[model samples]
Target: MKREIFVVADNIFTPLGKTTAENFENLKQGKSAIKQHHNAALSRQPFYAALFDKKEFPKEDRYTKFEQIVIASITDALQQSGLNTSDEKTVFILSSTKGNIGLLETETHTPELFDRISLSASAKLIAEYFGFKNQPIVVSNACISGVVAIITGMRLLRTGQYENAVIAGADVISEFILSGFESFQALSPGVCKPFDKDRDGLNLGEGAGTIILSSNPKYAGNIKALGGGISNDANHISGPSRTGKELSLAIDQAMKDADLSIGDISFISAHGTATSYNDEMEANAIALSGLESVPLNSLKANYGHTLGAAGLIESIVSVQSLKDHVVLPTMGFEERGVTRSVNVAKSIAASSKPNFLKTASGFGGCNAAIVFGK
Candidate 1:
């Protein structure tokens, strides 16, 4: 028998707000955190993205901007859960594509600074900072990093490996990352409009999100992690599967693992990056799963493509929606664009359902889906 895993507490730090409540409230009003930027080092052309206020962080040479974001989110989540970070039974997991890659621009750095560039090195630093007795674990699976981290935590808790798992994911927008996306001509010049006929490309954003999972009911509060499934189409490195059948399989398996059917899900938090290939692929996948009528929303317009933080941050908002019986609108969506039909929410609506699904896809053909319930 598997142990029940529940998300006891979560937090999000984004440009729209520092706390989850603040971010959700802003979303209710259909406000977007994405904006334009013209950083010379990042791009010669103008770019739009959602970014947190760097001035808010304390001046410290000991930690990188990425580490600071993770610390802030994890600290808030731990405080809310009242979990002992120093406990031997607690585990710390960090999810990200690039940790301190921005440090490479510096001409000279101490051995310690150089070491921090490695994802594992940064994870260990954060673990020691929190006094975690176990070695830190790092997940660097591109955009699916956050969702995969949550799934990893669920498995560990079910095995009784830890009493609590602190999962934090973050990716800062830097020249290293921005240039890569630009090379592919994937960055949008304006705020993203997922599922819209006028949608062009994705906007890169940065933020941190954390979720604390445990088997104890006290920490579970009102929501539980039913099950999660991950798959890869091996179709393309940057492009998604053309068939959408690959992602549908993952969704089907996730629902089955949760002992759920198509009718059980209330709403879907789709991995809608506002890209042409991505939106169409997801619509076909959802339709293939026989969920074309179920209301769904994409949060990219609110926070752009947050990369590693996308899954957890969007999932946190979904939890808030489930708790309040309100479904937030998919900001900037105007008209249908995909070949397959999908019920993309155009405005705020009320829902009475108790369960929701969160899904994401990423580079290297990775796809993941998870079910959560009250």
Candidate 2:
């Protein structure tokens, strides 16, 4: 028999709120953290984003902002799960596109600073802090890093290498991130509108999310990591596939792995980045998967695009939706924008659905899909 993986506990630490319950309540009330900012250190031009107050997260000499948020999120999750990290079967996985990349903005880069920039180095520090028995794993595969981390943890548990996996992902807004998005002209002028005709670009956000999974059925909640699939189009370094066939392939594989059909999925948590190409590509992929009518929503407008944390934070929200028996509306979505038809959620609705498909696409033509269910 296949080892069943259950989501034991989860946490969402964002500008909207710290706990998953708080964040879900805010989403239910249609509140958003995105707003205009004039921080010169981040960007010369004004931009919109969901950012944490500097006062709340002071510059720590011991840990960087990236590391701090990850620890905070994982700590919350671990507390909720009541799992002992010192157990030999417990493992840690960290996901981020830019781990301490902001350290590069310093005037003088020392060897110690250089070492701090390594993702594995940060992961090790976090693991040591919690006295984890095994070396931590790092996942930094563009924006899909979080989903990949979850899949990695799930596979590890199935292999009997670990009984419990503490998966956490985080990325903070910095000058390095803002400049890169500005170079691509992907930064939205105001709040982003995913899958909307008027949508122009994306907004960046900073946050951390953690989910704990265990092979033990005693840890089971209403949701579990049914299955996941990942693929790369190899089309462009910074662009996604044009036809969406590659992403469809991934979706197909995930469904196959989960032993599910289109009818089994009640809703979709789309990677609606609100960019011209990404939203269109996702719609095309959904249509190719014969899921054009499935209700879908993008949380990007509420928290902005959270980069490495996007997949985890979004997945956490989807899991919460399943628990609450509600489908969240896609904030800032108006009329449909993509060429292919897709059901963009416009308002909160009650649902008794037991399963949902969460999809994500990122630069480097990478895409991921995972099915979570009762």
lDDT of 1 by residue, 53-103 (tens): 668766748777888888988888888988888888899988998878888
- Top of the candidates by TM-score: 2
- TM-score of candidate 1 on Cα atoms, chains taken together: 0.97
The C-alpha stretches of model 2 lying farther than 4 A from their native spots are none
Q: What is the lDDT of residue 253 in candidate 2?
A: 85
Per-residue lDDT of candidate 2, residues 1-374 (tens digit): 66889999999999999999999999999999999999999999999999999998767677888899999999999999899999999989999999799978974788887887999889988998889989899999998899899989989998899999999999998899999999999999999999999999999999999999999878666488989999998899788899999899989988888888898787899999999999999999999999999899999999999989989999999999998888999999999999998999999998887999999988788999998898
| TM per prediction | 0.97, 0.98
Reference-based lDDT, each prediction: 0.88, 0.92
| Model 1 spans > 4 angstroms off | 58-60, 107-114
